[model samples]
Target: MNRKHFLSSFIAAATVLPTFKTLANTVESESSSFKIPPYLKQGDTIGITSPAGYITLEQIQPAVLQMQSWGFAIKIGDTIGKRDFTYGGTDEERLTDFQKMLDDPNIKAIMCARGGYGFVRIIDRLDFSTFQKNPKWIIGFSDITVLHCHLAKNYGIASIHSKMCNSFPDDWSKAELVQIETILSIKNALIGERMGYTAPAHPNNRQGKADGILVGGNLSIIETLAGSDSDLTTKNKILFIEDTGEYLYSVDRMLWNLKRSGKLKNLKGLIIGGFKVKPDDAGEEFGKTIYDIVSEKVKEYNYPVAFDFPVGHQRNNFALKCGANHTLTVSETGSVLQSF
Candidate 1:
């Protein structure tokens, strides 16, 4: 991506930019996508590790027990026992723990306890050969988006973008169980799935279908990888994005950056998860809800765009696939997501 493109897009605050022809380069979307790792069944062992931040041992047990109760055998990564401020320890220590779990054949899944911010420092150093050869579900959200993109893109493997390890897991709300089951099934995704939700559709929703590998995570981290190898190419695909701790204007800016970089041009569909909600009083800053900001800016396109699919910063975060093949459907009643 051209950093200059983002600057131009941010200033105009709209879709005013050069054409893809100007760039004259095309990155082909990989169609033969990989299968999402199967869901954890009874007797499967799930490994718990703190790769991005420090988690107190006392608090860690509860999270481990939570998984154990879910019928998964649990193992704690070595560095889950270490601590350095808000992190599990040195970058090397975190990397070792993560790699150990990733390399272990006994562990059916690797779940991070939390995501604060530490993976970037060690992303390039960690070895994923074992994982690529014998892939399993890698789950977490928030700052952990870093790992999702890295694992999905580099290895052409599937990973879960869902709740991370916490003393208090996301207890299901009264009406969210159906969506919750849909998300959990992603670990063991079956093809030709359908998932939809009630939403005020944009007039630009061409009322058609588009298929591509599902990609995207926290808006902040997605922007950070804009020009790097890990920076995902959104051509011919569905992009799901959500974030927290950002102003409404910042949300607009990142979407602009995505547009200018050609990330938004050829997208098949756009799924907007909950944006970072901050503590605020009664007043509208942008005079537009986050949904409005996204709809207005993205409406100019002719692809299907769905909002509020129960993913991201919200409490009942659904596990989403970052690089798996999926079909996106949108209509007045709701939206349907069919994973391959």
Candidate 2:
């Protein structure tokens, strides 16, 4: 070959090789196995931090006492009693407290004290380098869905979606059976028990079976994070969503957003949890039920759809291990979700 021709080919290969290498790295990262943080054992410390809403120390005592009874020590973050309006603390304060817990080697798991708003304000600023290396359980639902989705997208790490400190009953003896069962579900998940839950069949449910990673929380929060760094990748996953106090029209809009974003495509299954819709005003009624809205959006898909699968803001809300592989079975009689 001529010297000029050889040189031109070499330059072209050098440029193309780097691009191919980069694409390969991206694919490898996306297909990597999810990392499950070490489960808790008796006497392990569980740090409690308020990364979202404001909660006084007194408000968390119920949780603290309950966890203590379960044989786990508690490390209360400074933001527990600190408040800045609706937030647990200023953005800086909340971020620092959460970061400390993430980096602490002694803390086996970090349980969010409560969920309201403000996680997104600090999510971008908090560093995960140390936490990524020493992965630990991050527990909460509601607004904490932001963290669950963020960790899944960026690090492929597992976290718990369940009731937080704010949900603990002040008196266990007086607590309802459902509340006690839901709370115990967290302990079972933390201690590495294979968790399974069953929900009664709804007439709207589509019968089928699937096995995939579990991913989802509040529908509104999931929609809010769409297109961001924390947006969920729902393809080939079992997604369960629940929301509280949204109007039927608003729920329809969010479902449309999910459909338009291609979030509802592909295989696996869907679980629709509790949706506490707000009543419409006298003159402005949206004439569609939650079932109708979801069915319309997902009618084209063949994957199974389970309605009222008991994970949400309601009393039946049980602990779910997000980013973990799960088997979903939906039949005419009922639905079963089993974590592996």
On TM-score, the candidate that comes out on top is 2
lDDT string for model 1 (96-208, tens) is 88889988999988888888988888888887766766778887888888877776556556677777666243454533544345344333321212222233455434355
Q: What does candidate 2's lDDT look like per residue over 168-268, in tens digits? A: 99999999877888898888888887778888878999999998888899999999998788888887888989999999999999999999999898759
Error of 2 at 185 (Å): 0.3
Clash count for each candidate, listed in order shown: 14, 0
lDDT of each: 0.67, 0.85
Return the TM-score for each candidate structure: 0.79, 0.91
- Cα-lDDT of candidate 1: 0.67
Alpha carbon lDDT of residue 256, candidate 2? Answer: 94
For model 1 the TM-score comes to: 0.79
